[model samples]
Target: MLKLMSLEIRKHKLTGLIKGVLIANLIILGFMVLVLFVDQNEQVSTFTSFGDVFEGLFVFVKAVFIIFASALLGRLVIEEYRSNTISLLFMYPIPRKKLLTAKLIIVFLFTFCTIIISDLVLGALLFWINHFLQIIPGQLTWILVKDELVKLGTGALYAAGIGLIPLYFGMRKKSISATIISSVVLVTLISGGFDQARLGNFAAISISLGLIGIAIAYVSIRKIETDDIT
Candidate 1:
């Protein structure tokens, strides 16, 4: 199963997709930073702090991620069922839960890793620009780097939490198209709540909720049998 999974990944070139996403995110961040730099003044409005800048970028990028992922996963499930390849998936001796579990793991892990990589690139660019502009005049310190790393990692995890719903969609219904559409609608309606993630205690609550999303997806996947996959 693992080997087949690897083949599945290779066939799809999921890594390439992640790389494309990272590059796209970097491009978007670059444009945003350019705009902000042009608009900067002695009295910086909302964009005063490094945290605010980063958070603003995150909110924008994650909105794209959330919308695209929901539709992508929804379509992923829908296509599998529509194409009837799910029938082949059940041919192996593996339990249906294990198969679904593998797919869920692959999907969310890919989502999380891609997001983290994008943030890391964004952080690096931010620090470079700050240093170049002499905005943060000081020696390069490890603590600052560590803080950025933490934010990147934690922020990615939080984003992934919201994205895991795509896995649930794929698990419960094989129509990727429908799942993606529904996921997009849901994200649009609920994004306002998570948009406050930069505020106090929101990160912790978000991370906790992300774990819950994973748990729910696992439970949903476990309830079905191999035959039902068809």
Candidate 2:
């Protein structure tokens, strides 16, 4: 599995995916900075805890990660089918199920790790900015860190897990545009509804989506078993 994942990583090294992720992170940082300039009378000005700040930032984080996952799915899965390169992959000695599993794992790990690290860095920077600029009126504390850390961990997994939904659609339709579009729609609907409906908790929403993604992944794996690679 590790070897297969390594092969997957090498396949994408020259595809500009890494560069795109970096650029996205920079954009996220800029968004965080803009939050600093929110008017004093704005709703954002009322945040008084690191938890609130993290939640606010996560809205953007979730959107960004969802888009990132879509791109990865398009490149890794849909492109293979469109270009007829997945047939070549099927020629390998590995079972079709194992091969597909490896690809899914790569997407999950890459998306999960990137979001966690980016969120941590963004959180730290927000804390620093708030400490000096008093933009959000929050003080960073060890307890706050501990609390947010748990949320960050779960959120990262949730983001990664949700990518499998697009993976399923991409594999089933073999359409790159379809995969990306589905992700965008899913993110907008889930995030927007969760916020407007005053859902139980973001974590619960993430978990629910994660479970759905897992189910889709399972169906995808079963699919490739009978799917024609040609």
List residue ranges in candidate 1 displaced over 4 A.
Answer: 41-44, 133-144, 169-174, 185-201, 226-230
Q: What would the per-residue lDDT of candidate 1 be over residues 7-44, giving only the tens digit for each residue?
A: 65674565566565766786777776775676475364
Error of 1 at 61 (Å): 3.7
What TM-score does structure 1 among the candidates reach?
0.76
In angstroms, the error of model 1 at 178 is 3.6
Best by TM-score: 2
Candidate-wise lDDT, in order: 0.63, 0.78
Question: Which 10-residue window of candidate 1 scores lowest in summed lDDT?
Answer: 192-201
- Name the candidate that leads on lDDT: 2
Q: Positional deviation of 21 in candidate 2, in angstroms?
A: 1.9
lDDT of 2 by residue, 121-208 (tens): 8878877777777776646678888987887788778878887788767766788888998999888766665433633155577789
Per-candidate TM equals 0.76, 0.90
Q: How large is the C-alpha RMSD of every model relative to the true structure?
A: 3.7, 2.2
